[model samples]
Target: MGFPRWSRLGSDLRRAPGRVRARVTTARGRGGPSRRRSRTSHADPPRGGSCRPGRVGSRPHLRRHPRGHRGGHLLSTARSGDSGGECPLHRAAGARDISRCATSPPRHREAGGVRSLVRQPSRAFVSVRRFIAFGVAIVVIFSTLTARLYDLEIVRGDYYHQLSEQNRIVRLPVPAERGGIVDRNGYVLARNIPGFAISVIPVDLSRTREDELSQRLAALLDLPSDAIGDVIRAQRIRNPYEPVRISKTPVPREIALVVTERAELFPGVRVDPESIRFYVDGTLYAPVIGYTGPITEQELAKLKDSGYLPDDDVGRTGIEDVYEQFLRGTYGWREIERDAAQREIKTLALQRATVGNTVSLTIDDRLQKLLDAELRKGVDEDKFTQAVGVAINPQNGEILAMVSIPGYDNNMFARGISTAELAALNADDRHPLVNKAIGDRYPAGSTFKMVTGLSALSAGTATRDTVVNVSASSFSVSGTTFYDWRAHGSLDFVHGFAHSSDIYFYTLAAGTPFAPNVHGVGPDAIAKYARMLGFGAPTGIDLPGEDGGIMPDPQWKIATFDEPWTIGNTYQEAIGQGFVAVTPLQLLNAYASVANGGTLWQPHLLKQVTDAAGKTLPIPQWTSQKLDMTQENLRLIREAARRVVTIGHAYMPNLKIPIAGKTGTAEFGASAGKDSAGRNKLGFHNWFVSFVPQADNTDPTAQIAMAIFTYDSSKSLCELCLNPAVGMTQRILEQYLGPNK
Candidate 1:
């Protein structure tokens, strides 16, 4: 039943151990013809490379072409188009090579020479090759996708997660309540009161409804729609979720209610509670308490990192400006979740706000009121139009009471002053905002003589018994004549100062032309003592806008006036006349130093700070300097000051409490009229520098040192005798010391 199988066939179909291929043919059954077959013909080749008689199993099998290419030798393929032959297929009809056709060796050209043939590729070979290639491509694609997925999910997950959360969450700032200010006796100077504010959330408004909402808000709030739109647009660029306050100033309560109650009309509108400042007795304490206003663009740039919001209020001037860091409380926040429509859904977190600290000042409200009333009355009753009154505890420099006449109401600024109102304030000739107690400068007048007298005594120029003869109303030196306010026959140092004699102090500093024994120390000695006594500099009060007054020396005069020093200039400097200036506070502080027995204190108003937690914090101590001169010399000066109150030109010896002081009439400009001598008469700036309870005047016994200044009381009707400061100071002492009423 079996011939040898194809697998069992020998190496070359076993026709004597070598290949014996069959013949090849074309589809038209032509074989070994004279003409070559066309390249495109369907050719038949024997798959069993050789055929044997009567059996197919003994034939060697054909191997499929690995690359699936066609057109090779005729013995290469398995296509069956048996048109020609070489080896015989089978002699019997029952053979795998069914046709009993004759075949031959690998076909040769019987007519034409041997030619090339196209062998068709087998289907199995092409299919298996394509399958392997497709499998490799699929594996590479899947591997790349998997590696990218790993990097994205594991390497940078947190950064992307934060971005997603930021889109979903919106944060809003909750304003902290600003601090309060009170005087020493706990009377409120500046405190926060409840007010209303309007705000908009850009994220809550749909883009189509944005303009309509702005128009609605503008109509309700009585503001321009363009302004509201501008604000919303700006906020959208910054952060769409954060609320933008409509205006820095407070809105009306009725309007805020409309926005709240009619929520359907105003989509993103909110009514927020605002803190507004309430200044007690605004005008009376304007210079000390100051005022608050909206944070400016320049200030915002500097304060942005310090947690200041765009609509925040900041102190504008005075004490409010100085203590801003302590007064500005820390901010808080309330974060809530929102839905797709941007409506609040639930609370996520809450942080409560801190209230600002309470500041306690050294000022006494009662004494301030008393000084204010008296100073105003005296100035209004007389020709004087401007004045300053400041009282302090000489030992510690705690300001007791201070009043600058012609002061503006700080409440005007607190409530938001209009452009016209601010312009009016700036335009006022009398300068209502000047705070003359510390801001304005004036000549020292006779008050500076204390420095001169003390300097001469200290520098070996004179003693308590030193006297200079006064033969006339004027003194002449080197052909330059200087006139005194009045003349006396002969005066010692104490009486010279008590009488406020110009020639006596002048000859003490510039020396007598005829007397060789009396040596003069000149302007250097005067300037040294002036600087020694807290003159020519600011008293360093806690108030803003303090002016350091000028003290002229030979060098100072040359620098200021571009002129050389003169002996006459030295004589005038000795009288506190030629080139000297001092603020009311500086003069008060200096006299206070002398009254307290030669100790200068740094002037201040802040006494302590109380935080929100009910804890009191320590305040800085005012710097103090004890005098370099002997205590005995200070006592001698104090006796002269006492004698001025008793027997000097002011001659006001009975005011209830024992007083010692100097009275001054500083020459400023020429009067409108001329004197009897046809010269332009000088105008007098009256000043009263004094203190109370003379007990050799130690710190505890000398309760207060005060300076009263009135500008130009020298109309023909009110000369030096009618100096308004003298009456004002007298009235203040009487009311303060008399019955406690």
Candidate 2:
């Protein structure tokens, strides 16, 4: 039979039969048995053409091929001119040249019948492969999601759960009542009174309710509606859920009752019980008891760790401040469960607050009142700028009574004083805030004469009988005339101290031309004895802000003024003038030392501290030191001090109880006018330091030392005007001593 024309194309396809056979074998392995059958028979090539799966039927089923076998069959078909049928590559290549027809294998041409070797894959095979691939992708996606689920639900479940619970919980602070302060006699000085304070919870109120609530609160609190609204808005920005204090001022009992009864009308409003500080005799005890005020930002920074809140009140000065740790009670808190709208569902837990400790001061209430009255009287009568009085028990250094005239009421601070009132107080020149008894400094004046006399006796420069003649009222030293208020022709140590003879003391401090005269004790011994008696240093009183008086010496003069110490300086110091200054407490303590025969006691105000349960706590013990004075010198000095009251200008002739005291008239300020001989007239600072019971008494507890200080600006130098401190001292003594027999 003759060969068909299509048989010629089979010859061309058979040219690359080895390559085609290899590709067919690879496709079969990848597809397995099912894929092999489908690829071979279902999509077989017809005659001399290559068959490719239809692009439009389904997505191409990717079969894994060996490293370099991909598209090998297609490349072979493109190279062969006879592709058995119209191959895709032949069409892409345009018309095939008939010149290559002679190159066909004769064996291929000899065969008239041609077989289709390549097959077209069925749509079912493509669909099955696509479904299998999609199923694998779904399995991979599910496996990844399961891992994430395990991590979120099991690995960190507790941490996330706690965060969820926090959103439903709220904490609130409970303020503790501050402690009470009392006098040694069990009289309450500071206490708290129960009252009501208005607070607003911002989270519990809506915008519309806020305006209504503000108006209601303003009517009840006597505040402007806008002010209440502003406060609520500002507090909401800081803490939306916490209670904001609308008014800390204590509402009247009736008003509080009304608020509580009508609670339904005022949403988010609360009237909570609060303690307000009260002072029984606030003005009288202000200096010693101090006052309480709202915590300042500076104080809050320091005390915040100790449970202090920003709105809490704290002690600002005096004993209240010094013992703040014990007086400010520990605050407690409550944990409550709340709903989404921040309404309290239930209290989960609560910690109760502890009360503060009680402080008992050594001040005698009656005596304090008496002294305050007397000092105030003196200040009023004398037209004095300022005055301070202090009384101490010589035996134990207990401050029996202390008074600073023009004292302020501590209740003002407790109740909250306005800025204008505070400014007025600060503007006052008298300095009402200062505890002048211990904080103010003044010249020891002639009260220091005792120290000079004692020093002379201790140094053996003079004895009780050592005499100096005061023929002239004034004695000259380095051309500076040291004048005596009055002259005595001649006087011994006891008599000179009794008369407060300036010339006599100047002779002892600086040498003079007198019969039986001795060398002066000099500024060294004077300052030595003064300092040994607690002068030129703080008295170590329990109170804060004590001034250490100045005791000037040769070195001090050189250091302070770059001037050499002269006889004039020594003379001035001998009579407690010049640079010999001392606080009233220091003077009182020094006299106490002399009265007790040499022991200098550390003055104190606090006597005891007790807890809320009434258990006594350990307190600072009484401290004292024996001075450098010998028994003989103390006796002589004590006798002279006794004579100062008995026979000198300080004498209280009407009193029966024996008292010893020294009077001083310290010169200060500019010399207003010179005398006819060019002598300068000076102003005076009056001073008096004394103690009850003569030095001969052995009972330490019976001895009481005191100091009175006042200023005099009068240039006339009248004895009465310059000696108001002496009269005030006598009045205090009379009140303390009673009718003596």
Candidate 3:
């Protein structure tokens, strides 16, 4: 397009600086309407200006200014706009000041262009920086994670792997068969019987399903549901994989079949074959054989390392306990792989168990049964509260038959006794559990007269023919009157023992005015003989809980009763009273010593121990020691014992074999004098200690010694009338000796 006259004039003004300068100077000097209009036209748009499409090329009308001031003014105006305005270059360039366009320096204009260029950056550079920063952060985070992964997956891998494997693997125990207990005659005393046992696997059931499983088991086993739940819950806490036994006693065949057939109905339940303890003739041999039960917490603490688990059955008493190590076999185990639900996947390894050894006792079953029968008969007939009978081979100290009446069946303990049943057995006044033959202690009564007589002779206080004048029925000692059961005019030492004369023994033990020439043997000699005869000490039998009878001396009396020894005590002790006491076994063994020519044998019960393969094990030999007494004195006592059985009380009037024995009526309880009803209420513990074949008999090997002790809580009976112990003894002798030969 052709340039207009005004455009040409603007161009000519820009090119002709003198004419433009003269015009700007005239406008400034006048300060008139034209200069005010020029100032208003170049002023900045309202702070923030918006661009218009039609006004793109529009410019404010220019006011002329002097060329010298134009550069300075343009520079100041651009800087002020740039300081606070959003678009400083746009605002300053769009002003209608022609002087700025004509006079702004090239360097200042270049600076404005540079500021506009810096306000915005290219898209590519921004994207590249962000990518670099994000990459660095990702590297840092991943590096830390890799280190932790290395520690967990490589360095400590084996330790964590072991813990994980434990959850998947389980150990199942294979119990070994316990040994059998047999008597000397090859008769079994205790043995094992195979039975079915029900068990629960806790890990296989959920909490809500446990009650359903428990209910099913209770109905099948005839047990309390709560009891089943309790057992299962307890096993869950200990180890969910291990099975807890519900019952081991023999279950009904029908029940077993039902459980086996309906196995799917009872989840986590199992029926397996197991062994239960059985005692043959349990009641007859309970005292000797004892019983077995589950191992207790205290026993588990001691036996855990020894392969005993909490569910193991252990011997509780008698021979079973004494030989536990020999009877309890070695247990075995199998390592099994299991799923999370405790289902067995496969067996990894197995260890076979060894069977326990066999225990053989010295007891003869035939003789034991006979003794038991006779003792039971006597106890029932005499109304005795307790009774005991013991038989031993005097030659070797081997116990033949030991019987304690009112015995119980040991199978109750083996098959799991109820709390109430156990309480009743324990609450019984007569202790049926005790082996009374060796356990009960009683006053020796006249049975100990042999000790005093033998002591007097050994101390050189009297001879077989030495006489004591017993004209008076009673004697005085230290102002205490002592009486004999009856008065004998006179008696020698041999007759004194045979007659059981209290005064003769009293005069021999304490001093006598009628026999002043012969001194008494005194309490010292008596106690010495009592000890030499195995009193005041255990018999060292291979049994538990043996009671050693008391043999008192001055020192023992002072220590026990805190009292000085008086002459009356000596007088009473001379006839087996006062402080003298003896177990039936001890009394029998003592008499056996005399019968066997003064050799006291150490009693034992175990005859041998053999392995399951029938190989015998070496055991300690039987021990015996000779008594410190002359054979002559022993012969005299034996002769006196024979006379007592034959002549003293007529205890064995019809016996044919040369039998010798003594009868004792020991006073017990302060009410022995009279009862509340003033009846003759004296209570006596009757005793009969004996040996067959008198001391003079050539056949010493055929001799057998026995002791019988009986006591009743009511009504005293004479030794000659209701001495059932003696009666039982006679029958035993007759049976063993073939009707007394």
Residue pairs whose backbone atoms clash in candidate 3: none
Q: How accurate locally is residue 195 in candidate 2, as Cα lDDT from 0 to 100?
A: 74
Can you write out model 1's per-residue Cα lDDT over 117-149, one digit (the tens) per residue? 224465777898899999998999999988887
TM-score of each: 0.74, 0.74, 0.77
Model 2 error, position 246 (Å)? 5.5
Name model 3 segments beyond 4 Å from true.
1-149, 157-171, 209-230, 246-267, 476-479, 513-517, 670-680, 694-703, 717-722, 739-741
Candidate 3: Cα lDDT at 145:
96
- Candidate 1, clashing residue pairs? 29-83, 86-103, 86-104, 87-103, 87-104
Order the candidate numbers by TM-score, best to worst: 3, 1, 2
Q: After superposition, how far is residue 398 of candidate 3 from its true place, in Å?
A: 1.3
> Each model's C-alpha lDDT?
0.74, 0.74, 0.73
Where is model 1 poorest over a 10-residue stretch in terms of lDDT?
Answer: 105-114
- The alpha-carbon deviation from the true structure for residue 735 of candidate 3, after best TM-score superposition, in angstroms, is 1.2
* Candidate 1 wrongly placed segments (more than 4 Å): 1-156, 201-229, 236-242, 251-269, 512-517, 670-682, 694-700, 716-718
Tell me the spans in candidate 2 whose CA falls farther than 4 Å from its real position. 1-153, 163-171, 196-198, 204-234, 246-271, 514-516, 670-682, 694-701, 713-715, 720-722, 739-741
Candidate 2 lDDT by residue in tens digits, 276-328: 78889988988888888778799889988888898888878888888887788
